[model samples]
Target: MAGIYLHIPFCKKACHYCDFHFSTSLKNKEPLLKALAQEIILRADEFKDKIVETIYFGGGTPSILAVDEIKNIIKMLRENYEVIQVPEITLEANPDDLTDDKIKELAQTEINRLSIGVQSFGEKELQMMNRAHNAQEVKQCLQTATQYFDNITIDLMYGIPGLSNQEWKQNIQQALDFGISHISSYALTVEEGTALADFIKKGKYPAVDESLAAQHFDILVELLTQSGFDHYEISNFGKPNAYSKHNTSYWLGKSYLGFGPSAHSFNGDIRSWNVANNTKYIKSLSENQLPSTQEILTIKDRYNEYIMTGLRTIWGVSLNKISKDFGLETSAFLEKQVEPFLANGTLVLKQNQLKTTQKGKFLADGIASELFWV
Candidate 1:
């Protein structure tokens, strides 16, 4: 189908605002990678009839692995699945890990895209987030990575407590200066268990300002749009032909298999995720058992997922599909539900597709939740 996602659950250090499942310790790395490979082989039967179009290496820091380790995983995938001739293989990497030598070696692998985590170009922002990479490393990695790969996307964060609108613009400009084709920009959110949240609670750090974040988001969209980049998804921007195929598949509701601890997978109806604990995931897979829990989605669940994703993308929700799949009752209910939004200029209906207006872009998730079939 659309892709396979491998979660490399190891990071050099934890970012202050992240809540994703990852371990900073490398002690279980070898076992984890081995288990990751095993899990891929074990799940091959699940999608035997499907041809994979993309392979995404996500996570704690996929760049933390050596080139050979990365290669071995790709090798296992090749042995197990029917990957397309030129799959959109992506590696989520950090700046410090992508040395000149490392980039050279990665260029030789099947990986054709790099999604680098360069949270911000400002040293204060980087330090504030406790990101492993420094300002200089961000610049260095981009310059060197461009030399080797043309398809590159960088992650940028905005709305930090001390960051100003001007500094936010500068961060976007820095990415543009590198000729970066794709950008995944996000506002700094303090997840409940993250260090940032705890710090804010303890009065050691300031809380995130929603108005400030909205300002940053507006600037980002305006700047990137003027630079000839398409605002493909709410948090993603890309030049022509540079959008992330793997992630696009997700927004479009295509099935993909995720390997490694805390990874998720979905078929048309069933959604599953591996255990978040590294040791438990490895132990189960070692015993030839899948370490995952799954649920068969109900009609209401599917409709809600579509509404959540569709409104966030350039391609909005299709009323016709809703009618056909969930029947006219659901479609009519949705049409009725959207009356307030349509009248307020926050939504538009065109060719049977319900889309978010620019004013509603930042509030897509909220809008989707309100529209869900409760």
Candidate 2:
């Protein structure tokens, strides 16, 4: 099965720490939407025979669009692709954009999942991140959202410089109280060229505390697990039936087509990404060209990718699969490298799947990099 990702590169405002490709202008939105629809039709043949199981509308702020626009895009995809029945169609939305009327309209479409960006329920943290939604809006949006969507996931962030541990707990508690089925919590990092980075460079804001971040991550695992949520990925927790199918397919090395500006697509070997500039993207597409770059993955590149993606999830890396796909020598090399983490109790080999232990999860990226082939 394959999935599809459509990037909507427009946001109401830039977040303090965001690094994703997006524009603050709506001047080109109409053209961008048309280009995206054209892209869907143009790329339909790419994944022709594969069953489309998931379609994700992600971006700067997918919720910012009008309900009719979202419906039109979905309609276009359906006309062009063999989209599966009951596909996991998710739209990433900001809390401010979720109104009762919008939620009702969303329910009428084929979209079945809502991934709300409710970074924090604390007013102070929300303002610090320059988020448009207030604490009350998050509560209201989730309340209204649950009325229409059962497969709901909320995005959250921890490790804000001024956010306290108690506040962090409250964020998770809020998701639980709202009965949100999935939580995608991430540690706030100061990306270069972002407003937060500039503030830090000017001594106006302090750098994020790495130790505090790690402490919060530990708390996240303990609390979410106790709440009966699967700490499935390092940054994601889901109730038994709520795991994100689109993201899971990516981790499992499934092929997917990505449309619109800055979207990336992977076909198990070659990977490609569209241009980040919205104006250029629309111009190129208007000229009947897809503004994108492509790369053919070498064996080592594929192995490294597998290490990165597989190690970050509960499914982990399969020794036999690695041996069969990458050969015995490569598998032996990985086994030897993984021995230290295994002995340190940071990783465990269970049922031939090597997964990280709770204590080792915080350092997952480092461990995966260590196992990477040259």
Candidate 3:
């Protein structure tokens, strides 16, 4: 199966910690939407033989678009591609953009899921991050959104400087009170070139404490698991059968096509991404050409990716599949590399599957990196 992703590269405001490709200006919004539709039609042949089970509208901020604009994109996909009757169409939104009227309008369309970007529920934390929404808006939006969308997911951020454990616990409790099905929580990372990074460099903002982040992570895992949510991935918690189909498909290495500026696409072997510059993306699409670069995956590259993704999810890396796909020598090398971790109780071999123990879940990425074929 395959999935489709559309990246809306426009945001109303720039957050302090964000490094994703986006423009605060909407000068190119109209032309960009037209180009996105054209890109969809131009790339239809890639997924002609496959069925699209999920369509994700990721952002800068997808909720910035009007409902009709979203509908037009869906119409184009339906006409050009073999989409399933009830595909899981998700739109990533900000709490500020999701008004009562907006929520009602979205329910009328084919979009079935909403992934709200409610980073935190603390006003001081929100202001520190320069978020467009306040704590009240988060509450208002969730109260309205939960009434309309059952398959809703909200994002939360931990590891903010000066945000105490008590405040973080309150954030988790608030989200649980909303009764949403899925939660995507992430640590506050300081990406280079972002405002947060600049602040830290200038001593305007405090540096992130990794030890505190680890404590918050442990709290999150304990709380969510106690609340009957599955810690399906390192950063995701979901109710039974409520996992994100689009993201889960991506983690499983399923083929997907991404449209718009700075979007990435993958078939089984080759991965491609569009130019990050909006003007250049528009100019190339205007000339009926796809402005993207691609890389063909080597066997080693694929194996490493499998190991990385496998260890992060509930489904660990399969030894038998590794042997079948990468040959016995590669499998043997993996076995040898994983010996230390297995002996340290970080990983265990259950039914020929190398799965991480709870002790290693927080460090899954590091463990996967150690097992990578160099």
Candidate 4:
């Protein structure tokens, strides 16, 4: 099944370590939303009639939109696309924007899932990240959201410099206490040109301790597992039957349509992304021209993608599927190469699937890179 991802390229403030494309200005929100609707209608033919199993409203903060604005987009999707009868519609929201009234309004929409950004349960860390929400708001927002929504997932950050292991433990406990069925926890990474990077350069903030980050990751694995959450992806944990279908589709290499600035869309072989500039994207779409660049994945690129995605999930890489898709020789090469990691207890060979062991999860990216086809 296919999916749709709409990027609302606007935020109230910039987080220090964020490298995503977003504007702090709401000057073009209205026009951009309309343009996005048009883009969806215009590009409906791309999917050829695949049922959309998920529709994700992700961004700077989709919760900022009014009830009517959100409903309009849902209406547009229903009219243009072959959406699943009970599609997983998720909206990524910041805690500050999740007022009771807003949550109630959102509950009335076709949107069935809420992914709240509750980065940390520490006020000090929240300020350090320049996040718009405070620790208290995270609890209140989740409590309010639970009143109306059951399919909820929360985004959390871990291993911020100066955030002690105890504090990280508190954050995990807080998420569990809130009764959120799904969680996406990630380590803090300083991207180039981000304020956090500059601060580290100036010795204003401590450099990210890789050792400390690893410790925190281990804590996450232990706690989440004890709490009955499956470590479905390296960063995502879910209770039984609560995995994120939208993101899972991406990892599984299923095709999806992405609308709005900085959004990327994929159809079997080609991938395309809209311009990162919100103004440029809106202007071009207003003129009835979609501003996007396209790339066709070579066989090597496809095989690399498969290897990268397969190793990160519980499902693992299917050697038989790889042989069928890429050729027997390529699969044989991977089988031989992976034997070393398997011998080291970092990889496992079960049935026809090749999966990473628990010890291999933290170094998943490095391991995936080694398996990449030239």
lDDT for model 1 comes to 0.94
Q: After superposition, how far is residue 129 of candidate 1 from its true place, in Å?
A: 0.4
RMSD to truth, every model: 0.6, 0.9, 0.7, 1.0
Measured with C-alpha atoms, the lDDT of residue 152 in candidate 3 is: 96
- lDDT string for model 2 (219-253, tens) is 89899999999999999999999999999999989
Considering TM-score, which of the candidate structures 1 and 4 is the better prediction for this target? 1
For each candidate, give its TM-score against the true structure: 0.99, 0.98, 0.99, 0.98
By TM-score, is 1 or 2 better? 1
Model 1 spans with C-alpha error above 4 angstroms = none
Order of the predicted models by lDDT, top scorer first: 3, 1, 2, 4
In candidate 3 the C-alpha lDDT for residue 248 amounts to: 95
Which residues of candidate 2, in runs, are more than 4 Å off? Answer: none
> What lDDT tens digits, residue by residue, belong to model 3 across residues 1-374?
89999999999899999999999999999999988988998998999898999999998999999999999999999999999999999999999999999999999999999999999999999999999999999999999999999999999999999999999999999999999889999999999999999999999999999999999999999999999999999999999989999999988999999999999999989999999999999999999999899999999999999999999999889999999999999999999999999999999999999998988998899999999999
- lDDT minimum window of 10 residues, candidate 3: 354-363
Measured with C-alpha atoms, the lDDT of residue 79 in candidate 3 is 98
lDDT of model number 4:
0.91
For candidate 3, the per-residue lDDT at 136 reads: 97
Write model 4 residue lDDT over 219-312, tens digit each, in one string: 9999999999999998999998999999999999999999989999998799999999988888898899989999999999999998999899
Which candidate do you rate higher for lDDT, 1 or 3? Answer: 3
- lDDT of candidate model 3 versus the reference: 0.95
